[model samples]
Target: MPTYSRFLKEILSGKRDCDVKKMINLTENCSAIILNQMPPKLKDRGSFSIPCAIKTLEIGNALCDLGASVSLMPYSVFTKLEIGDLVPTNITLQLADRSVKYPIGKVEDVPLRVGKFIIPVDFVVLDIDEDAHVPIILGRSFFATAGAIIDVKQGVITLKVGNDSLTFDLTNTMHYPSSPSENCFFVDSLDPLVHDMHEHLLISNDPLDLAILNREGLGNLGVEVAKYKEQ
Candidate 1:
């Protein structure tokens, strides 16, 4: 009989023939991994957006993305809206294509009316060509401020303020234009290089900021970014 160490060394060295078992006991997690019993993969659900307005200007489709650290607005849109004076900022943004972009300026506390809730949003103004379909990117910062609850599986997003809450169904809300010129814009990544100004401008303490919706502007609230109606 070989010693325990010698027996193990022989087995490892293939000097001794070891019996192979057809079945082996495994932990639940291991079994799941080996049997490929993980959650089913889902297709790209496209982007999630909401109808938002800044004062009088109605932004038909504002892309709500979790990938971005800060909200983004185009210079063209900035020029059109009289939300606030563009405050100069040193914060840098890196886009999806790994291209670096310097924002034109920053706008603070712009009242964004979504559904019946009025939430204050800070936007980083960029010089990119405004996508007629989706003009803005509402990043994680806005989500944090708005107390947003996203259900990717069901394609539902609920925004809460204090005790009040509003929900939107993406299936009905996402309408694309039939025009050939309509372009799609997406923010896959964002790298905000923090500076002195960036450090001071943190997420607002009052996340649940809310205001009553004006009945006079109800007509503009229904405007969709795209031209076509989706069934």
Candidate 2:
């Protein structure tokens, strides 16, 4: 059976007897945090990668982006999930390169399964490039709510949920494609055009200085400078 069909069937089936929200409470010792750590790799190519689950379905390629304010997902993924009903939003996202893309809208109550933790967040649906390698973009919205701690050197992302720390390793899954900057985050042009007034040209405050260039000839040259009296 298709994943989407199953999801809809379950939704239509009925609500389960549960608290709904993933809950966590800590003790006085703070022993609940185990310092979720990943094994040190012989050759660690630091990349922000983590496994994300939507409706308990693991998203193979999910990129962890700290620069982004809100979590984002391609509209294509939304269509694949067959999730219905999204709130209308008029938000404009500015790319790293300064270009902007408008999102279709936002879907509330979207829970992302990160490790054993359930991250309740919203995603702004947008039309992403079809060729985009990463299907899901985990932005700061998830990070802040999840209390994520990413260790770049160790290539690990850990989320402190309640008293447990859920971890995902990047060394095994994240692929560092050639010229990644062009693929994921927008790359700003190093050389930007700077505008300034040409220094060589100067205006004469006194028409006496321009007396050398006859005003009569200036009219013939299709050039005239406005004269102002010194206050």
Candidate 3:
């Protein structure tokens, strides 16, 4: 073996030892890998859902989607519950596909029974086909009202209400609903149009004018008239 002149000189001079092992520091990641101390790889647990009810009618599973701004309910479900009258809302929803969907109305303070807790939730009623598996989408509004703390790694979700708390294990209870033909959509924008017609519709006591605006005013305002089905 051909040794470098510098190294040979150092070895002969007794300044450096040939058989000495030098210690080097390793990064935390590298040390973990070498020592097999890395965390165990976990598989995708899927979407979080919980069994909730409105009165005696048990809604199968409600998908807890953080991406949605408003808690959404199909008009069909609202009718089935027959809980209360839907108040007219000026808020307009723009979907993920950039399509505008007009909500039928807003249902306020509907009691949602989850486990031992009866929480009040406001839902934006939309005219859309209800999913058999997961009929309702619980968004940030519901989460905030319920005080939801999602633990993605542990696959657990904790819902706190005052001094009480309820935790659901997503690993065991997670719902994997069969993929529907409709693309998954979320509310991307809220009340985009600042038109006078929308404002008038809000305060207009004349049913005839409100009806006319609901039919033609949105289209006339350059807002694309699209149904939730298209989204």
Candidate 4:
């Protein structure tokens, strides 16, 4: 029978008590179940047990990698942070869904908790958003640094270092977003012509033409003058 037909029949027939072992075999045999277990569709939501303490640091209100030669956050997020201020330490971290390995680094003045052992780490903090029930974020910076992968479905967070990947299943926990902030892009000028020119120059490979047109003081008046001459 077709899988959808079986699903529909089950739905119409209502719940029935089934043998546990047989149900397990049936579930294992289901093609849809097998496909859903693939990485992309696997919605392993919620927190898993972590073997090590997650650390945090605030590097001058900017997210910086702990060591030199590390990848830096984009200017958009970096500019908002203050320098030299001891940012919050010791926040919980949720891991990524995929199981790839990467590098790790240390930071200072960060909150670190591992199992029942909480320690302080001098490390840059990573910003991860867990707003949805199945949070899909584990900052690329930290992931690149620490080389970790989080399998929510399996309830494990794996850390890879030097060709070996370590897995940890954190104690089940609830994760939530910190706060909602209104993100706005403020423009100083409301002039349509200025806006159009700005966009054109920004996307244009040869911005020099726009620069020459602007510097020469040839605004729309030049266009009018040319039209009159042509007439």
Candidate 5:
């Protein structure tokens, strides 16, 4: 097993802001971040990092996604397992598409380069559904520790962590959109005045009536509310 001491910094496009504190916690504990259809809610506060594959379009190359997710495992962990030691195990993985159960295991010790950072991670290779054509799926543990921002929009996944950001267009990637009805409409533009007022009222001392705003979608309104509080 080899220890990764170098830290990589890269910028990616089409990223949505994430709570920095939450990200730190995820890295510290080696937890995976799941992007799903339901409204955001925190769970699995503390747990052992699992080795799994990460599938996304913005990843560009197959190696990028593999390196992003499994690097969290310390060098000691890698040494404990051999190529055959890791076997196919059932695990649930979350992606922008659909959540599915897959078999994955720590296959080999591989070095991943993210800008200036070089990390050695235990590669968890697995065969996704028959429809999956990508090489592997990177787990959340590796991604969180990479200190990058992951963005999903218009079927694209982008990762920007550190000073460099990379975008992966999923036009040809293995994607499983949960359902057509699950799609949410995004507002292209909003009046600054209305936006400011809406934000102010939502963050005011009194409870807000978020339901009143029908013009803007609830997701946009909710994000605005969260931004107000975050500020």
Candidate 6:
């Protein structure tokens, strides 16, 4: 059995040595940051929840998920709106959790009144009956426009609109279940090299403390390999 420290080391080294199953068990049960191990009171402490409204209807806690490409507005919110001009769209969407298809109507530019600001946003209308809590999903569109830095661990969402800034307290935060078997690995993020280490994660100690994120994928595999060798 691998200890938490050992597993952490393996992850840093990109060493996928342990069997998938055992590696997950160690992370799920013994990790210091295990979600289920936290006190119930601290569950909502680290979240990025905010309130938005359309006309008189209060849109529930809008989850700012940077992963999602499109902002989702449930049918419930559309029904509450005093005015909605649904343009005809032949768009079919496959939600994250399910494989079933959702018939999407035309996008609506909904004027959302968030705090002191009135931001008009284009929302993809869909019936999200599957999701129990999230009524509105603020995707990349919101982040790009608002310039929000969503730090989940610190439980802070700092939004920068030009020179002005605003922060919101999260309510009904997301909780991670002890389901290591389901999610075991994370995608790699390249940061500026501070120290040269043997781990493949960082090739070498470079004078520049910044590295470009691997967004282009394996297309430049040979170049990356040569860079690593040179380092």
Best by TM-score: 3
Model 1: per-residue lDDT, tens digit, 1-231?
A: 669989899999999999876877899999999999989988667778889888788888889888999999999998998777999999999888798999999999988999899899899999988888788889898998899999988889999999999998886555555356556666453445444434443432221211013222444334321211331
Please provide TM-scores, in order, for all candidate models, with all chains considered together: 0.62, 0.56, 0.64, 0.25, 0.27, 0.50
* RMSD (CA, Å), each prediction: 22.0, 25.8, 13.4, 16.9, 27.9, 25.3
Tens-place lDDT digits, model 2, residues 67-113: 88888878888877766677899899998879999998888878777
Which scores greater on lDDT, model 2 or model 6?
Answer: 2
Better of 4 and 5 by lDDT: 5
Clashing residue pairs in all predictions, respectively, total 0, 0, 0, 20, 20, 2
Ranking by lDDT: 3, 1, 2, 6, 5, 4
After superposing candidate 2, which stretches have Cα over 4 Å from the reference? 1-46, 178-231
Give per-residue CA lDDT, model 3, range 5-27, as digits (tens).
87888899998888978899999
**Ordering by TM-score:** 3, 1, 2, 6, 5, 4
**Local distance difference test, candidate 4:** 0.42
- Tens digits of lDDT, candidate 6, 1-231: 669888889888989565565333566556655556754444345435588787886755677776777787777667767465777666676667667555456456677777776766777788666344557788888777777777655567777876778877553455542244556577564553432332443453331211343433556555665666677
Clash pairs of candidate 1? none
Q: Model 5, 70-131: lDDT tens per residue?
A: 42222233343332466454545454456653535555445555334544445554443321
105 Cα displacement, candidate 1 (Å) = 0.7
Model 6, stretches more than 4 Å misplaced? 1-47, 130-132, 175-231
Model number with the top lDDT: 3
Candidate with more favorable, higher lDDT: 2 or 4: 2
For model 2, what is the error of residue 176's alpha carbon versus the real structure, in angstroms, after optimal superposition? 2.3
What's model 4's TM-score? 0.25
Candidate 4 root-mean-square deviation in Å: 16.9
